[model samples]
Target: MKSISSADKLEDQKFNALRLRQLTETNPSIRAEFGESGDNVAMLIDAISRADALSKSQHIWYIDMIEKRYDDLAENEIDDIDTSDKDLKRLHDDLRENLIATITSVSIHSDNIKKSIAETPDAVQLLVNAMHYRGREELRTTAVVAIRTLCSLDSNKILFAKAEKIFKYLTRMFDFRDGLVLKAAFGTILSLWSFLDDTESNSVFTIEPSVKAHVIKGIIKLIEARCFLDDVLEFLARLSIHDDATEKMVMYDATTCLFYVLRKNPSLHTKENCAVILHAICCKKDHRTLIEMRSEEKSRRTLSRLVEGGTPRAIIKVNGILERLKE
Candidate 1:
């Protein structure tokens, strides 16, 4: 094994020099010469695997090199170039697989590599499947992170489709009583929300209403848990902007949640937060039903706060809602 390690080390040194030449040579002929061989791809993967097996330090270096190489490739105008080359595809697949495998092996410390792995559409689904295959909490969490990072970086339709699978998994996990799972679930929801557009929010092809309802329920449960109130608030704020009937439903629950939170602990419900909720409530025409559900005196008091004593910002938000209400 030591001799194999030394041989691998010498081979890797030569491979690194060739790889650098491939990256730096701008001449098409030179690039073609350096990039032509099936052996180059095989050697790169072999070097990565040997590094993984031998020394942790060398493994990190090889992974870092692979990441930088990919970043360089992405920065190229090569999107127009025919990377349909079989050798290139083989190299891509090999690198992606080893990257994902390495990431899953040491989930926490490999977040950067996980992020790089996610750059490939195929790799995103692979990680999503690995999450199910491993079922280790840390691995699942890492997979969620990878999915989110990919969603952030790439608007590729296939990546978004992969994200749907991750979203469903996380939504289910959110119901767990475990705090860490709940946190990961919240992060996943935010990522899913980030990818949604007006059309998708309303489109039959996107997340179903039932799933949206379950997401709302999960959010409400999280709010009740009092674990991530700020995140809950931000998520609600974003969902309120979603263009669908579900947004209205979310606003209704949010209004009720805010009311419950305020009524339960009157002192904490600063005039400012109360005013914001009041304004949010009035923003929706449907919210009148919710407001009417409140006792008359409470409703009148909320109205007064909105119309009179709340902050200027709150007054403005409420006034807008009132105008919408009149129509």
Candidate 2:
């Protein structure tokens, strides 16, 4: 018999990696054998690591494996690895890093993967911890993406609203200089703000008074750039659900921001959100006339465009706000 060469061993590992991906996809029983709740988590991590260096197809399979692992872990009771156990901790970190990478990658199943992470009690906290202390931009970006994805669901939004520490960490990320990082942070904040509509005491989205002013300032600063214009508008629009938030948007010259964005031909969503913010600003007794006279023509024109070209929901919102303006 011929002796097996190192190349042969490497090929075998890659082949095994591909088969593992296939089996995991086709057979949940086999998949559970390598789940995060089982003893095979280390083996899964090892396979993922080896798969990453293989062909593009294998790398994608690795991402799928990571996503499935996250889903499986989400269904089981969470148990943190002992930090004192160096080997276990290393494996934990590796698994988490791979998870972040997979979350950031392109995939049609991203929403399902995100929901899985959101379902996991410790998963959001783990990502937050990594973002707060990891110092790596890529990891931080991934964490923000993961958080944003979680916020996409109403159930997850309520859950996140109760996670004060996660929101606090996300607020701090707004101060980061990286543009991509800033955008991701903004998206996460917007998601958190969506929780504001919840009336339940546990569902209230809280921004401590101490950080409120800082957050307002950070948002306005980000709005100065054209790239973040729509994001800022949408954030303010959602934020306007509270009168105080509307006041802050006006104080930050949001009218001016809206005027420019509308003129530049923003998307229907942006236009609709801008109308909401404007409507909210106009609803305030003190600020109403001032904003009305300041940009009356521009606002009307923007509303017309939205009415003509917006989505059914956007059309309804803008039309109602317009009637209110007319009154």
Candidate 3:
């Protein structure tokens, strides 16, 4: 007998969840048994949890279905008849959940659906709304995933970055302890950071102090947890390109995380990136001494270890930082 791999199990889960979602949305028997809103929220949450198992084609099909469901809800206007506050909230929440669920499964190059989502003014707002409510980490994770995917395109990045509240929402999303959410949040920031250019009047990266501190805190926590080190380190490296971000990294004790990562025998690419980031910090006019002191507690013990065991490229980068610090 063949063992079911995790991937296979996940696919099975997604299939079952999708079928259940279909049933709740269409079949009256199951719909009546669970009532209207309960089944939809449960099934939508399940679908979102298993969304990664879906293939690209499945994403497209599911996205279309989700959109149709969203449209049906809007067209029905359940709130019109059910004027109760609780009922209205439920209806509004369902509508938001539908949009979040749709965008959650949406990935890059998802064709018209991605384009439609980017073009829809309410789409970004709905994502932020889904993230803003407390105790909705899963929904927030899904929304950040959507943002991460959307930011991969320069046009979409520009569109989303223009949303005045998005920067703050993204910064707050880092407060979620979930690894997936943090990864997606960092990915979105990195994408938007890359998209920033002085040439465009509308393009900007707002660095709210508290928000920036929270983001840095989130990055450090992710590093400490050893979650998504490659992506996290890469994000730090890119963020270091800005002097303010570099200074903040030092203020937030990023050198300690970088040294810990280097000592852990990470992948060669990660080591190289770590070296580059440390080098960047060392080159900073204001924070170089602080980073150097932190990194050289035992007289360059960290850099020496990398030079001894790291790849040739890593060694060169590390040596370059050392040489620069001497100057």
Each model's lDDT comes to 0.49, 0.57, 0.61
Best by lDDT: 3
TM-score quality measure for candidate 2: 0.50
Clashes of 2: 0
Q: Residue by residue across 1-327, what tens digits does model 3's lDDT show?
A: 011123255434434444444554565566444333333434443343333223223435545755675556664464543344344334333433443544444333244445555665455555555566553355567677767876776667867776666766777776677767777887787677556644234635555555556666667777877878888887777677777777777777788778878767788889888988887777774455554545574664778778887778778878887676555
Candidate 2 lDDT at 169 equals: 78
> Compared with the true structure, what per-residue lDDT tens digits does model 2 show for residues 1-327?
011112255434434444444555566565443342322333333333333333234435545755666556643332331222333333334434444444333111445444554555455555566567533465566667766656776667766666646656786787677887887787776666655645535745556644454466567667666648766877767677876776776666666666667667778787778777766766774455455534656645766777788778777766776676665
Q: Give the Å shift of residue 300 in candidate 1.
A: 8.9
Tens-place lDDT per residue, model 1, 1-327, is 122224444444434434443342334444343234334323433444443333334435555756666566654544433333333333333333334333333222233333434443345555565345322355455455545544444343335554445555666666567676577567767766655643474662466665677676667677666657766755665555444534545443655566555444433224445445445555555645544534532554554444565567656665665555455
TM-score against native, each model: 0.49, 0.50, 0.61
**RMSD of model 2 against the true structure:** 14.0
Q: By the lDDT metric, which is better: model 1 or model 2?
A: 2
Runs of candidate 3 exceeding 4 Å displacement: 1-95, 103-110, 177-179, 197-217, 285-300, 324-327
Report the backbone clash tally of model 3. Answer: 0
Ranking by TM-score: 3, 2, 1
- TM-score of the candidate numbered 1? 0.49
Better of 1 and 3 by lDDT: 3
lDDT of 1 at 103: 35
